[model samples]
Target: MKTVYIGTYPPRRCGIGTFTQNLLQAMSGKDDSPKSKKGFFVVAMNDFDQEYDYPEEVGFTIRQECQRDYQEAAEYINLSGADCCILEHEFGIFGGRNGVYILSLLHRLKIPLIVTLHTVLKTPSYEQKEILQRICRTANRVVVMSHHAVEFLEDIYDVPKEKIAYIEHGVPDYKFLQQEAKKEFKLDKRKVLLTFGFVSRNKGIETAIKALPEVVKKHPEVLYVVLGKTHPHVLHYVGEEYRNYLIQLVSELHLENNVVFIDKFASQPELFKYLYAADIYLTPYLNEAQITSGTLSYAVGVGCPVVSTPYWHAVELLADDRGILFDFSNHAQLADILIDLLDHPEKRLRLSRNAYEYGREITWPKIGAKYNNLVKEVTAEQLKIPRKKSIPFDIKILPPFSLAHVKRLTDHTGIIQHTKFGIPNLKEGYCLDDNARALIMALMAYKETKSQKALEFCPVYLSFIYYMQNDDGTFHNFLNFDRTFVEEQGSEDSFGRAIWALGYMLDNAPNDSYSQIGKYMLDKSVPVFDNLRSVRSIANVILGISYYLKNNMGDDVMIERLRKLTAFLVEEYRQNSHADWKWYEILFAYDNGLLPLAMLHAADILKDEEVRRIAFESMQFLSDITLKEGYLSIIGNEKWYHREDTRSDFAQQPVDAMCMVLMFYQAYKMTDNIDYLKKLFASFMWFLGENDLRLSLYNYETEGCFDGLEREGISRNQGAESTLAYLISYLVVLEAHKNYYSKYWQQNQTEDLTSNE
Candidate 1:
């Protein structure tokens, strides 16, 4: 389809210019056939007496402060045989008050129009509101990045909800590796804190500089890197006044050694590299109404943990532990958060992971696809073509399993609890929780690919389990940087997880040596199940026992232990199973699927029909609540689903989605019902943009899944647990699809032979 984009195209030093160029590049990349390539023409916006070495794609140039240029461009577009025109709208980019000059072009445009709004002010002036309203009325579709912008447009600007489409600000798909970039820049040892973009008072760089004194008190070796030159408009008018003020402040605070300024506009790769080198990214912008910040997007994209004032974009992107948000201009709170994260390296690592994982959906390819789809919809509507009712299932090709981030989190001893972005934070020390899950992930990878690399991790993880185990068979969860155990007997969940890992290793160990190690740990941990009181812990133990019985059948002691655990679970279910509430607990929280899944496994091993019935019934109840509207509507971790209270719809986790996939697969296996298989695919598709937000949780580039889905957006953190959950679910889904397709082929062959006979 032929399309024209009106914007400040690149060769111009503006965020909107970069966005327009990126969008065109992505669209062109997606279209492989050069002969039938979609015409992506650009009408560049320029300032008075300003000139750029425009590329061949530019069809026309409109002076920003010129009124007649807009009408001329519109007339040219009308005669150009373009199917649709997409205007990248920013008030300052166009001429006249509130950019009302764009109305002249909109009035004359004959083709379908889609206007992508870069900013939506919550409280717009009368003229500002009217101009936007006119644009909304004139355009076939209005695009916004944040949901808050959509709300503001609809409520405050009187724009209809149907007219607005929420597409996230585009971020480049960069790998989550920071240490190598740090080494390249000779910043391998320093704690690199960064804020990049055009220097402006609204950017609130002064606040970050103010916060640095407190931050440097704890982290004396901290380096605050301020990249990017002053904003072009700020440079043209103010002559670096704000930049001078910031430099003076750094000197006055005795932070000359800490602050380093690179006064130039960084290219995309350079920007990403700088972001990678950063331990924490800061965006202390003063404008709460600011809806989009490309710097923030890039920082989160490269997996930098952010500490920002809660602007509209930051508030949406940094929700759910993805980043820490301080109030606007609150340098003290910013300092406190920075110090706290620096002191507790584990939390910083977690924040970085969250940001990177969440950033996957907002990357250019995904955003471009969303834009393309919207354009198609607009064109189809204009041409009176019947569009498909359901979105086509575009199965994302999963990347080959890489131990890149996983190995980053792991040291010579064990996997650390967190990372600062993708760099391991050794100060957080080691944890059995991650090592246990990592063990299963490695084994699963080895089982599927039979790679020696996957097997190499097995011993490290197995040894970690051995390290955490006590003489009486209990395991410690946390280990400090000095290799000291923090707790005597770890939480019930940790012990149960260690057992689960051991059981998996025993069932699917690559060799006899691994199996022997697994068997010893399994035996040592089996007797500890009698002490587990938490339903999830007991449920986890039951799963481990089921795995054990799968390999070594007719073990009477293991059978009795399994039976006792099953009885306890059944009693719990009976007590809690009311008319509508059919769960083990009053609230449906994390790992809720494990309870029913454990029952399903127990029923198979024990051959108990009652237990099987309860398992199916309870699973059905859980599915009924979670699989609403044919999507995985997870019970929110923030405020879980209580018996009498409303179900919190967000903070839905990858673990929960992974658990549901397992439960559905088991249910389908036991019943041979195709309906269960359908649910399995749907739940699996939750990671692939089949969820409520229509955003993918899986990052194909990083091979990591986002931590959770929040009310505002997906959690950007690509932590160990969430990444493992996606890999596990992905492998299972791959197996199911393989088996399914294989069976169809065999059945079809039989039918052909029978028909010939």
Candidate 2:
């Protein structure tokens, strides 16, 4: 009995073994045939004690043995061959450096050895070069499926030209194999492009994605089917990194509607079914090999029109009469091909039929006869023996980070705000730059209208920004966007915004339990306080607000730290700080009110004259940053990021509503300066209500947040948030009502707004 093993057998579960088993079954069949000499085959160098049924037809046998020694096994198999021996040689499955043992065994067989080169190396390694050279010296015949490969090896290696035999990879014959059905839509309507095969790094799935815009315009239905996952061995060189890179590129390009990545394995029959569904088959591969294309063969075998890179092997297949050979280096050219192919339907059918005609001639019986001829010739020859050993195999499996300690992880959060996605924690695959404005919009809407949907975005935004805060409060740039949903913690400014949002949410929310949770989490953190600008500013800000809300100052250290932070704000915003006063003003104004509240608490506790000075100075910046227009101007150049028509759209201008809110309350408490209070009140109403209450709802947009306008008769600006901002705007007008019963407001909307409260 002779055993030939291919895939991982018995104990190991692998795809290649499954393919090999099917191949064996096709050769052996259900009933034993006297004409066939095929027997139990374990083609593997190392055999597991366990045995797995081939599931091939029947009457088949497997001769198994432990390959303690490869060269010895080769000699034993050769001596016992009683006929011939075949070895399946692929650079990936067999050990690169030790792969020569397969050839050495062929040498020992001398009776006749036919080696099937499973893979043709486009980028052959040093060990691969050495093995190919040794195989050249030993094997009586080499079987290659590609003609280009015959020429390539002839030029690259010292192998005899006549010694190599070419037999195309086989595909099962099926109906619809030769038919190119009229597209559901007009042939020119859309491009239903398809990609099926192992998805590996160099396979360049992204190239196809980048070309989608052009394809879609020509054929709107240019749907892409990324039919299968990758070969296990392919990941060793490329790793799972490329898979992620491709996914992000797809998202960034907004191809979610056109591209469908089916990360599943398909059988031979299923593969054909998928191909038949496509308008054009795409193989935008970066690498070209002379050897073989299992996928291309399948596509062509089923008469699918293709658009592929002009690799040496691809040239051979299509040079005769197949499909278009394009430059793999140019992305636009590849996309253009797809566009052209989708536009020309009859042309595609003509080429597809021609390729399938070629495929049909490649029957297993003919291929087996080639093998028989090689074996006959090899057995007739005399040869010397060589010694070698068995090979090892391994798989790539990333260790899982079980979220078993989710609470343990969340426990590290400074304030248990909410679940954040696509924010500061990078949300893995979600792009922060893409969502920053959206994030801000979501938060502002949450604050203004208090909509459930808007408020719900709070946890998401907080989680997005907070996950970046490590134990030590530092941030990373990248995170596992897939396996790990949240990734790198980014810049300080990003964190600061997140921190401010968290504080604002914590301060105003009616939820007391969450407030307590925030205080606790902050307390348990890695004791990060006024250390760095990014870390300290935000940390102290949270603590100051937390102490005020909880009415609990744990220790004097925190109180002192808060004072120092207030002092830093004061010094940072000195009248001559730089740029415009507004930049410093926004930060100062933001810190001013909270710091004053902190200072007020300290004044009651420490009785420090310095604390009183800082509190007073903090409140003073509001007046300094105010413009003559009764509104606080943005910091720096107002024209920096605005359209001419969109006046008062200061890119860095200070926010008038917030400044007025702070100043009006302060003036009311400070003295009988009713004028200051009145001014603050008028500014709030005029500035906020001037836009027709436009800024009220945050003018929601398509970016999944309240960012821009609601002009399409769509009341995007209405929600929990619109209600909140309106509520605040209404409060100011109410306060000024007692002083001035402005006839203009009453003549129109003012009376109704006033009555709203």
Candidate 3:
């Protein structure tokens, strides 16, 4: 079975790059025939602007920061005829914040995936933890070198234990040549102490350097060799500052004769020679968080007795006298341990014997065979599972309807405008915009489910709208929890939303009392529509007026009102819109889909073909921009996208996603097009986890949706606006499922019964 590996490869100086090259070599094994190499290849990751003269096995190259490159790389792998893909996952190796851009490629892969996590932090940043969790979900098996990493994955990241595979870091298969290697490296007369791998400040080389003075005083013939070049990224950004400091410390301590810095990357044969030459391997890493250390593994594998700081990897690898551990940056303690080990040659030999016995299990060939087995197993399982020819146009995959969050956010005063995570933030208080949205959501829930609990919320949210309205019919936008208005006049958007709620209630009220109250408020607000200039405001009012006309078709005054509003919106489209830019405004901002939705409603109400034409044209434009990726990537609210500017990818808000879902639902209803139904479901899924981040914004635990998608991660606050938007989109999808999928199923059932009769 051929496998494709995705990561940094040889000819790049990165540690992960070297590891990939070694893994590929080991997995291909002693069979050097063409059959062994057939169809097995590497998709190398290039650091920004740096290209490699890679071997033919490197099938594709992804620029670290170019997101499009990752997508194209996946397409290449999908068509490469490789049975499975193994990804080497290191946070900084991929592009975007915490390397989030890799998700795009992972999502597109058609083959089975296995990801080897090189680093698993005990305490991770929000983006780091979320990105790792997403990767775990995508991979069929998550490989980690240390058992500590496995525990972290299950406990910290919540990855299932069955999904995780504990595979030790592969080490080179070589015999012990401590004295012979010392002679080959020309250190036969001098006792050698070695530390290797790409040198960085975090390696805590100074502690080892500082410890050398005492070691040399005790054994003047000792040679402390620091092998490998400075880390490439560190060299690029900070130059040789870290290397220089080590040299300076050695100079100040007058141990320059005993200490040596071999500033170059070693070949595998040479690296093993250096490992064999060592009396002991030292990895004085300052942080205890290092989950896996390949350098340390190589030392233990070669039977080189190791003395290292108690990093997570060392603690486990050195446990039960396999090796020795020293305190981080504790030079005196390290020095004392080195002296004792040197004095007792038998103790060092015993440690080496234990290390070699343990290393036999993790030799590169054995580890490679283990990986080969995992790949075959995953590929076979994938082949056994039948592939679905097409996605079903139904809600079978959608989560069940939930209003637990809505109830939590709602008090007698109405749904709170904001939340601190899942809890309602009283300091932010209530807003008419959210209350209007909440009212409409309640009405949809009550209509869809006929739940008395849902019906009960209608009056609560309706009461909030009544409380926010001024005597002039204009509404107050914000209200404190103490029942005081923050503003005398609300924005046109809030006014429009209030009208939408009232109009929807008038058409689908639970009782005559609600209809009477809705009609009274809607009638009082009629004068505001004539003066409405904001396209979004007019669109909201137009939608409300159309809903009102559904119950009052004979009301020509309302009909004229609808006609004038549609005309204004159409005129706005004609004036500001061009062939390339088919929008009511030059810039696309929040709640953009509302514009086309209003026109669609008006077109159906008045049967105006021209209005319908513009609506469809503009809706197509919106869909082309947002749904072009085959998933809903909502227009971000960060300095909104203009006609000629580069569109921002974030922060994507749920309200925008909700608008898309609602608009597409309307489009499907008008055209009976299955494509619209597909787009509608895709937009709705943006809440569940199908968007840019691939991290679910809707928290199932709280049943509350996150506020938005920032570039770094999902905004943690589960505000009322986002939560309400999620519910509204969810209900619309459910309604569509009932109307289309459920109805179709019922039709099939009826035909089956008739045939039996």
lDDT to native, each model: 0.83, 0.49, 0.89
- Which pairs clash in the backbone of model 1? 349-419, 349-420, 353-717, 353-718, 354-716, 354-717, 358-716
TM-score of each predicted structure versus truth: 0.54, 0.44, 0.86
Best by lDDT, which number?
3
Scored against the true structure, residue 360 in model 3 reaches a CA lDDT of: 86
Q: Could you tally the backbone clashes for each prediction?
A: 7, 41, 0
User: Candidate 3 on 264-328: residue-level lDDT in tens?
Assistant: 98888898988888888899999899999999898888888999999999999988798988888
Could you give candidate 2's per-residue lDDT for residues 1-757 as a string of tens digits? 2334333432233434444544444454433353443664555423334444543322222222311244455545655544555556665444313343343244444455556666666556443554576666556678777776676578776678888887666555555522343242223343567787777767778888888877677666677878777655566466767677878987998888788778777665566667776667878788675356667776787778888887666777776668887777677998777776666777898988898788777644444444555656666663433554421101121112111111111222221221232112323243222222223434444444455654544455445444544666544323344424344555544444334444445554446754664444445432544454742344335433443443445666656655565565555445433433322333332223334443444444445676556555544544554434343432323333221223222222112343344445544444445555555554443322222111222211111112112221113222222222333333334434433334334556866877897
Least well predicted 10-residue stretch by lDDT in candidate 1: 390-399
The predicted structure with the larger lDDT, 1 or 3, is 3
Kindly list the per-residue Cα lDDT of model 1 for residues 1-757, writing each as its tens digit.
7889999987988889999988887766654244433488899999766999988788999997666687799889999999889999998888765576677677678889999999888877644665677688879999988888888988888888898898888897766367899999899989999999888889989898999998898899999999989988788888989989989999999999999989998888888888888899999999797898888988887778999998998999899888989988889998999899899999988998888788887889888888888889998898885566542122455556566667666667877766554445677787887788889888888877676877788888889889999999899999898889999979999888888888877788788998887888888877788888999888888887888889888789889999999999999988888987888888887888988999999999999999999999999999998886577877888877789998876688888888898898888778767677778888887886666545567664465666777654556567777777877787777666665667768999999999999
List the candidate numbers ranked by lDDT, top first. 3, 1, 2
**Deviation in angstroms for 540 in model 3?**
1.0
- Answer with 1 or 2, whichever has the higher lDDT: 1
